[model samples]
Target: MNDDTGGGPARGVSGGSWERATLEKLVFATLKEQRSVRRWRMFSRLLWLAVLGAIAWYFLQQQTLGAVQSTPHTAVIEIRGEIASGASASADSIVSSLKTAFEDRGAQAVVLLIDSPGGSPVQAGIINDEITRLKGLHKKKVYAVVEETCASAAYYIAAAADEIYVDKASLVGSIGVLMDGFGFTGLMEKLGIERRLMTAGENKAMLDPFSPQNPEQSAYIQNMLGEIHGQFIEVVKRGRGARLKETPDMFSGLVWSGPRAVELGLADGLGSLDTVARDVVKAEDIVDYTQRENLGSRLARQFGASVGEGFFLAAKASGVQLK
Candidate 1:
């Protein structure tokens, strides 16, 4: 049979170098067989690159959409969520929002939308101080529109507003100070758990759960509450001025529904954010400046806050009140 070019395998360079010719043919055949694999691999890599590019584009678009924007023409700020020390929705957040509103040339008046049950008295006072400062410095009118629940420290914050509004059913008031925790001395005894505590002053651990309540301790804690209460009362008096019709029972740490709140001068009007913006501000446009609490921290706070509030309400119901 002919091995190459119709000639049998021969000596080197004989019959047109039959062996070299056969080798060339074999090499050419291998290259032809590999061509499809190389081309397909390149195509697949290109396709994957395109897919990754699309995914990156989608994420970029989502981020832009999720970012908060400053509202032009009218500046509306929010103080929703719990107000606490160093919280995202705390005094600093509201203060910064007010500052931004005042600085914005398009903002006619700063709108403060509040939705909180209040928090630290110190935080609330700081917020009130900042509101006063911003108003004085900027000479801009600020309105506090209450939503859901603007009680206690929330009202303290709202008191600094030029006007106040609440929904018909929104909970308001709770104009008092409180501190609640468990007394676990008995529980510790039952659980056989020893509580190790140290303090320079005997009164330093007055509120400690593991410590037994002393008469002097009770007196001291009451005095502290009274002092905070007085500060809260003064803030409300200053904010509402003569509009506030102070009742004997109003400021006893009692929370009320919006209707009673409006009737008692705790809240000026009754309506939600939508109604207030449309009718009160006379502008449909609104902006939010409130910072949302992260899920982890928010949930962590929920239990303690709710339990403390439940006890506080029970105490208030038993005869104590707030205005």
Candidate 2:
């Protein structure tokens, strides 16, 4: 063996084996580094899975709602919610529902089973106008059956109906226009708050409820109320025609029970929803058209509404200071 050179055949073989062992260690370390990269990718994949699950849940909810609305039905409609613009009997809600009902082939007639204390005049007028137009176009029979109360704007709407029925104790008729606001003159004085109002016109702040009332202002307000009341009287007379009894006390903003209403010629008969549906509309099926928002959606809407209201209040409080 060439021991001096350390390159004898056997010695050379041992050196080559040592070099291969060193190379193997480096390759194993590189494999472990690649494994660490794979572990990071797995973690990211898990996060994306959670995100996808949430998205899938949202879509599933939406699909469920869509399916529920797709269910079909028959017969008359139920108008048993509050009547107001943007409040309950919103124009959009009522008109859309009415349109759907009219389009339904099975629906023979539209029955307004009303039981409300009345609300927004504009909303009521719009609804009345729509009802009139729809009746003329479709030649459909529309009946207003007052359950408990159909006063003010509610009665206004009822006038548009082909016929009106009421229960014995139902309070109907508040045919008048009235505005209410607190007079904070005393409270402001008591609290030592300064009154600083600047108006471009004399009547710009004519109806300011915070300021003291002058004789001229009082006369103006009375005249305005009288005018509105006159409008209400005219509408009632037009709708009821010869059916409305001519009496000095008829337009006295009097509220009467259902039985009293019939005596007063405000309603045609006495009955309830079922009686009206079976007897008048001749259909027992009822459909609701009012908006149906979920609790979360409703809460979100309420939150946004309250926020907007607070913003306006802050602005009015800072500038107008009028009640």
Candidate 3:
């Protein structure tokens, strides 16, 4: 028999070569997979490091920026927007900023730049108390400058200031308390819808919109509101002292123009922030001492709440308002 026709060295050499080629291909594929995994791992690590670095930089900027100024300037804390808990004009932020501004030696005087319809009597009271305490401790003067409107709780806060300045046309003086909400009981009745509510206490669902109005509850609410209104009146009286001219409509939740407010002793005079910074404080330079939320703080606050939610909770709990 011929060697080529049978299983011989030539056929064996070809089979060995084929096996070697397959082995080499398998090794290459394994190396390639490992390289891919390593690349991905390195990329993941780099991304994580980048995130950490960004966070660190952001924090560093927040700590260092606007911390020091060479010149003596008027420190301004903005009390704009709705005054509620955790808001920019809230007691926490406003009081903290006021403390910082007062503590700063470079700041000649602290200015509260206010422009709002006002909100949250408790929050405003906290800020007002802090301002008074800080003034006594630091011996720093606080001037409230109103841009547009400083009614209700805003006036409560402004009353704590040394003096209040407003534009001629600015609306001011709604020093009162009120609780406003829509009653859906009538609407539900019109729609022939019955609300099924169950609670541990009869007063648990006291302010439930869908429920029918209870006479006892209404009287109780009115009494509570009256007490809080008395507190508000006391705060304004204490803060304003003899400056507040006692009038029937002053604390009756009536709003007034800036000129009329000055005439009624609700405001001191008509002046803008620029004029006050330049003429009153005698410091033409104005430095903002407002504790504004940075990116990190804002992101953290996103998990928190809004002003409306705070007002709702306050109303639900206290059945009172300074809005």
Candidate 4:
């Protein structure tokens, strides 16, 4: 009976010891899982903090640069790429830069560094008017230094400058307007497809590529283009005065080399930004007053554009341009 009782106690103790060991193992495993989760959460938080810190630093840097003042320098506003309403070389951005440059006490003169194939005429006209107004108000001479190609709308803005400088090999003309598109009517006919378009007014579908060409509409568009062309010619005449040597093909949508342009009185002489700054403005040091879009703004613009790309394409198909 004693042996039996001893055996029973020994078995009970062994079972209790096994249960305690299993419980200890489970507790340790649970603690390890919690520790891993906590580490990951901490790492994620740190990563987000780092990104926020970087963005803050970038904006602060830009603000600091804009606030700092320096000795007398030539303030440059870059007009590169297509000068559309929402583009980098837009009238609003250029005009804002011009205002800042003109207002600054350290700015000796304003320089327009142009390199473009041209874009919207309306935008160019706004910039041209502002340049003239600013020049009169501030009494600061504005110089246009052309690089590569300065044509159509680009030249429209440059016309407001006191003088225009260009490289010898640069293309400096194409003083004209255009409205470009493709006619898919022929292709649709070949593919045996039908176009069912609805419009509120007869003229609403005037330039629709899928519809047959209307002679009356075409004539009206031609007349309107001629009027705009006439206005462009008058602007050039006013800007160049007696310097321009008018020719039959001067405004015939023809591009000219820089040297040829100077001979034809389209430009002043062969010069670059550096030479013009040192000789004309008398300021060797240059400071850019151009307003640039920040990273966040660019990313937001890109995201919005992606969402509206289809709508933009449809409108662009029938839009007029100055190129």
* Candidate 2 per-residue C-alpha lDDT over 33-84 given as tens digits, one digit per residue, 9 for 90 to 100: 9877865655554455445555556755763343233333323444555676
Write the candidate numbers in order of decreasing lDDT. 4, 3, 1, 2
Per-model root-mean-square deviation over C-alphas: 16.1, 11.9, 10.8, 10.3
- Candidate 3 residue spans exceeding 4 A from truth: 1-63, 295-323
Q: lDDT scores for all predictions?
A: 0.74, 0.72, 0.84, 0.86
Instruction: Please give, for residues 104-155, the per-residue lDDT of candidate 1 as tens digits.
Output: 6555566777888788888888888988998898887778888788888889
TM-score for all models, in order of appearance:
0.66, 0.68, 0.80, 0.76
Model 2, runs deviating above 4 Å: 1-82, 294-323
- Of candidate 4, the 10-residue stretch with the lowest lDDT total is 306-315
RMSD of candidate 3 to the truth, in angstroms, is 10.8
Residue 155 in candidate 3, Cα distance off native in Å: 1.1
Winner on TM-score (3 vs 4): 3
lDDT at 264, model 2: 76
Tell how far residue 183 is off in model 1, in angstroms: 1.5
Q: lDDT score, residue 163, model 2? A: 77
Error of 2 at 28 (Å): 16
Query: How many angstroms is residue 275 displaced in model 3 relative to the true structure, after the best TM-score fit?
Result: 0.8
List residue ranges in candidate 4 displaced over 4 A.
1-60, 63-68, 295-323
List ranges where model 1 is wrong by over 4 Å.
Answer: 1-72, 189-199, 291-323
lDDT of 3 by residue, 1-323 (tens): 68566768788889999999999999999999997786666556555545655775687486546845668999898989999986778888888888878888888999899998999999998899999999999998999999999998999899899999999999998877889776898888889998999899879998788887889999999999999899888888887788878887778899999999988888899999999999999998998878766665554355234434544544544557656
Clashing pairs in 4: none
Instruction: For candidate 4, write residues 213-271 as lDDT tens digits.
Output: 89999889989989888878888888888899989999999999999999999999999
